[model samples]
Target: MSETARPAGRVDTNMAHPARRYNYWLGGKDNFAADRASGDQVAAVFPTVRRAARENRAFLQRAVGFLAREAGIRQFLDIGTGLPTVDNTHDVAQRIAPQSRIVYVDNDPLVMAHARALLTSSAEGASVYIERDLRDPGSILEAPELHATLDLRQPVGLTLLAILHFVRDFEDPYGVVARLVDAMPSGSYVVMSHGTYDGVPAETVTKLEEANAASGGLSRPRSRTEFTRFLDGLELVEPGVVPIGDWRPSPGTRPPEPADICMYGAVARIP
Candidate 1:
């Protein structure tokens, strides 16, 4: 499908979209010049950002591996599904269990343009994409594409990695998480990774914030205490919420310094 055919309106290459900027950070070529500029600005303040992005993707693969291989989760609702990269949730899950079903949600037209990459599933599995915003959990939960691909009655691995930080306090991010978690069955899982200003130097945080603000972006890094509220009623898995790199790192993988990661990741069971 062409960019102009997206129902979300025409794609604006001039604007620095978070997904496109993130694509630039991850070394993907689908982003425009505006996205590269925004990504460069953020990287200038936090030189480890590119490393953090790669580490975050590795964290996602590990988390999904655990969910699919160990936890036996066959359904996934990956909201804020950014530009496709290696080992996406469906790829990881379907690799372990070929029958896995996944529904990806995102509002970015650029992401939608690359939906084909995310939609490729094994013969025994299924994948679908929904052009929706994270601010509306009700709509995401009610989306026909989601319901059609995934059975809400079964356990679902809900992933919100590196996306909630964009959902500011006014949007009640905690409430949004609660709504999605509430919709899942008892055995459902919530896998998340959120950016934090905790260990970073104050000056670096300030510069990053200023750059994001100048680009018409919003990023609110929460404290460990504040971040925990999003998984309030769920039962946390092993090594509960910790720095992304520290969360079940694969053997021989040298985790970056906690100060450099600047993100917290965790998996929980909705009992």
Candidate 2:
């Protein structure tokens, strides 16, 4: 496993981090009491939240596989990578193309402590982790570690799964996405999955919103139109933006109802 300069920061067990809360939802034990409290608060209102997390994760794995196997991509930039579990970006990509290189970016210090786990790359490929906020695209792009692992001159598969919703409008989510996309080459592609309330009932959406606010959670589900704006000029791949599970599901597999997942996923070519 290889890594760049490790950024120093304390893990605040008193407050919940999106990454740790997500870990808790995924049934991982690397979370603290605050994360559990926050996760349970949302789960109480939206009972299918755990399923949503799983569906989002499944979409990520599928997208990575498609990028490496079908799209012939050999480089990946996975932003907002939560605590690693299974089928990580490198795992899926390297399985198809062993020379695939991956650069994972996450702001959580706890994720950095666990970077070694994510950095286990196939001997023919490379993987590196960077502790940097997605809000600051410039910093992440300028980091020496990124250039060392990936060649910006080549196409890259940028995956932003289930993370942008936390980037509130005030944080300039559009700007963050645009800056990252602008840095990639024309043939590059972007895979994104975002939380939404489109198929959910108005009453349930209201309750979920209140629950998140009460728990001090940062989740901000966006509407389809709003989320579509993030891909303004990109060419969307077939099976365009749809419910998380609707995107290229494995043959004969049954997908959850859009209301059950309440998330949208898509992949678009940079051209």
Each model's RMSD to truth, in Å?
2.4, 2.1
- Candidate No. with top TM-score: 2
Which regions of candidate 1 fall more than 4 Å away from where they truly are?
1-7
What are the lDDT figures for the candidates, one per model? 0.88, 0.91
TM values, all candidates: 0.95, 0.96
Output the number of the lDDT-best candidate.
Answer: 2
- Give a tens-digit lDDT track for model 2, residues 1-271: 2354445567889888999999999999999998998889889878999999999999999988988988999999999989989999999999999999999999898897787665599999999988888998998899888999999999999999999999989999999999999999989999999999997878888888887887675888899999999999999998999998999998899999998899999999999
What are the clash counts of all predictions, listed in order?
Answer: 0, 0
Q: What is the clash tally of candidate 1?
A: 0
| Ten contiguous residues minimizing lDDT sum, candidate 1 | 1-10
Alpha-carbon shift of residue 59 in model 1 (angstroms): 0.8
